[model samples]
Target: MRAHYRGWEEGDGPLLAAVTVLGRTGPQVHFDGIPLIGRPVTAVETDITRHVTDNNLGLRFASRGDLGLYGLGVWVRSARVGDTSVSEARIGAEEWEEE
Candidate 1:
């Protein structure tokens, strides 16, 4: 699967993968080492970015045999400490005064 992006917001992005058939059998999606053939297809891999946030996203996956696959997992984005933009933050006290 592969994709390309050009600053579009939501509902836009090339197909990461689309295998209608694989090696003489119907293509399938796998989750956590299990085959998700008859499960309800619900999750998707999303890429999220908004001002000062440039990163990839990986979230929520499930399988059909899951009895209580009732929760989600993620390679979480850490609690962002502060804005990382250096150019936007002034260096001098006067920069913060008389504004």
Candidate 2:
């Protein structure tokens, strides 16, 4: 599954956000097209990471098909637009799910 968040606006400068994920050990997490966690050989239950971008933030997760009963939970810890703190923005929260 893939989750993309775009909350930055004009003159926002740089936005920084943090997210926590709860899932099985097999899921891979990526931020801004870069691998952040979920190494193939390591197993972990949760991941807390941060990302900074000017206008767009991208989050992606990948797992093997054979892993049955797949589930993932994402929590927005905090978000900042420039120097102002803003509420968590989930414009297309449901878009993360597969059709």
TM-score of each: 0.18, 0.19
TM-score of 1: 0.18
Tens-digit lDDT track of model 2 for 19-79: 3332223144543353333332211112222332233443444342111111233322223
Screening candidate 2 with a backbone cut-off below 3 angstroms (N, C-alpha, C), the clashing residue pairs are: none
Alpha-carbon error at 23 in model 1, in Å? Answer: 15
Question: Each candidate's root-mean-square deviation in Å?
Answer: 21.1, 16.4
Model 2 stretches with alpha carbons more than 4 Å out: 1-24, 38-99
lDDT of 2 at 9: 75
TM-score attained by model 2: 0.19
Ten-residue stretch with the least lDDT total in model 1: 85-94
lDDT for model 2, please. Answer: 0.31
Taking the candidates one at a time, how many backbone clashes does each contain? 0, 0
